[model samples]
Target: MAITQPEEDIEPTGTKTKWQRFKSKYFRMKMLIWWTLLGVALGIILGAALYSVHPSSVVITLIGYPGELLIRALQELVLPLMVFALMSGVFNLRHSGSGTGRIIRWSLLYYLLSMILAVILGIALVFIIRPGRSRPFAANNFANCNSNVTATGATRADKSAVDSLLNIGRDIIPTNIVAAAAAPNFLGVITFAIVFAAGLITFGQRAEPLIQILEMCNEVFMKIIYAVIACTPIGVASLLASTILKSCSIISLLKALALYVATVLGGFLIHSFVLLPLTLIVLSQNNPIKVIRSFLPAIFVGVGTSSSAATMPVTMKCGEDYGCVPSIVRFVVPMGTNVNRDGAALYEAVSVIFIVQAHGLTLSVGNVIVVALTATLAAIGSASIPNSALVSMITVLQALSLQEYIPDVAVLYSVDWLLGMIRTATNIWGDACACVVVDTWARRHAKKNGTLPIKNPEPPAEQEMAMGVDSSKKDEVI
Candidate 1:
């Protein structure tokens, strides 16, 4: 060996080997995985133990309240950031002057069609899963815990179709902008932001300063978002443990828990694995699996954090890495985070129906349709943050008077964190799908204009060179 060492066998003494590097990297990832697993395990254990010892303890309240507060704080950051980011993105694309019209048309079409598909799929799944029919959950317990019915009010007041439609229209446009911003209606904020950004963009040179300022504000808000996200695991653990301990019973958990879990998981599977991909394939003419693989990390983070807004940066980064056009990713992902709530829609519809059936409420076809539509629209109006579901649910129940039959809002208390996680996952998936659809459209336009390379094009010069073929010979062969 000393006489003649093979060139491939040579090694440097000061540098670490590939195996060593891999080990270091692997250990770091492993530690993170183990830490997360430990957190979840502890949460489950504490939750179960607390339920057994005392169903309603002050300790639970202390932990639960702060966790809830933290979630609200995170939510408060989402609406403005989303609006600014999305509008900025859209304005940038418009200014680029490259197929802006086509991009806008395709994006709008894809968004609307995909949402309709998701709604239909959600309704179908809710009916098929029938998680609510497993057992007749005690009406009083459910009413006491989950009801939106007030003590003095009747729960069964029927509203006409005309009234419901009018109420929806009124709620969409807020009377006071300040009040809306203070409460943080994402849709309202988005409406304001889009008009603001559009106006700023129209001013050209005069708007330059304003655009710069808005961009700076967006950056600052993102920093705040990051700080908030850093605290998520602890907040989630506390929230989950406290909720489980306070509201869930071992008997109920054993009986209806599986049904709840199945319905959620099943709905997610159908949306993520089936409906979303098909939409991408059909509309964008792209490979859905590729989009999914690219978005996996963001999806995981969204599920863990239970927030699409919190996951926005990661989602945008992932979209760019996966070859999504910046214009499309920036516009569609942020907007989808706010409005494209496929998962929330699915979960809300299923949960409402489940609760109703569990309580042995005889729901007519009209009731089911109303619940589905209400859930979908309510989810759209919901702020893109954590723990906003209860508020949104309150609005929906009030509108429909479903709360009259169920008097207490406490039933949702036990599973808020779990449902939040599921909803967040769903929201993230919808955003990813939106990116795919937008990217497909952008790429196709780019290709048509000869900006992007053609798919399955002829071999590059290097490959031809390696094959010992001259340009002239290659042309002749072709």
Candidate 2:
């Protein structure tokens, strides 16, 4: 007989090599890098093309509308799923009686503190960098671009700082859930989810069946999300191709583009890379680099899509993979994606300052305060829906009665896709950081209390029976 090598050895090695290649190809890092470059090129070319066209044409609107529609479909799924998933998860934890209250309190405190710190850092950076002072282009070039462009007939109004704050508070509560859901207001969805989740928890074990059903529903919804993400490359390609077809000389808008890009990058580096990591190291004793490394996929998708809502599923997955409890990831990340917008907050602040300085308008102390408050509230009020920020930013400017000085919102709209990616990436980074902090705290608390954290204990009878089986087996062998 001819010498026959062991088939098993050859088969296993070949299989292993194929599996390794597959994993690397599907790795989030590779996906992120490739998609992000595609998005950037598309945004620059399309933005320039849109700018070049004198009068708005039907072709530009046709190509742009599909991208906008895809964003809307994505937004429709965000709020209901977030509400259902978060409420079910939170209520489940509450039932476990495993120090969930402490975790929630700590996470909330971190979110609030981080928001304030982001604002402070943004204002300080704007003052230091003086991004407004770098007037590489003539003001005249942008003057025609400054005319007020509003869909609604509302004119810019003059309002006191107090009035603006009151308005923001008033808008937070949704009068009708149906209306809010249809329009897809994130704040309203969050409010509804928290209340609903709290009610389920208060009912205790009586709500267990309902919670289980909701968990099933959450899984179904996630599968739907996966399907959507699979189609991302096609949506992205159409969006980019249309952008390129419209803009011929895309390279000319580099100066203003550079300023906008630098502001976002600088802010993200400081908050995500430096400030947030330092906080985690000191308070939670976790390695900052490990946390960053764990969140690479979420960060990449966030930047690529520029929609925090779009990046939610990936963010949750990354958090779970990084040793976070599923309950924590389910609850914290969705909420953080909507409310904790460090990058968007920074962008709004810097953009307002840049616009004012560009137009030679000096902001008073009161104006600066109003800008900060407006940016924070606007960031909070932003619908997780795509392109919603464009409209919302206008509302914010109008709220401050500063719309006239910064009348044309389209100036910022031009670079919105690019900025959205950065903002979403920062939001995901914050969410991952929150997960790590909360997980570490929960683990330490459980260890100190001499109890297993959030996991079911073995039944006494089952434990004894297992021991008896082992003893009997040993006797037989002897």
lDDT of each: 0.58, 0.58
Writing each residue's lDDT as its tens digit, candidate 1 over 1-478 gives 3686653343346644434543443353334334434445666676776666664356766766646765566446655555556564445533433335555566556656655666666667656766655443432332255544333322223445566555444545778767766654433545666677777777777777877677677667756765664554565567657645644354564456567657767777777788888787777777887778888898887766666765776787788798765545655665676667887777666666665655545455455555666666566655565545544554334434454322222334345556677667777877887777767766676678777522211223432222222222222210
Q: Give candidate 2 misplaced runs (Cα > 4 Å).
A: 1-56, 88-92, 98-100, 119-157, 182-185, 225-253, 277-478
Pairs with steric clashes in candidate 2: 49-247, 306-420, 306-421
- Write down the lDDT that model 1 would get: 0.58
- Model 2, TM vs. native: 0.55
All candidates' TM-scores?
A: 0.58, 0.55
Error of 1 at 337 (Å): 9.1
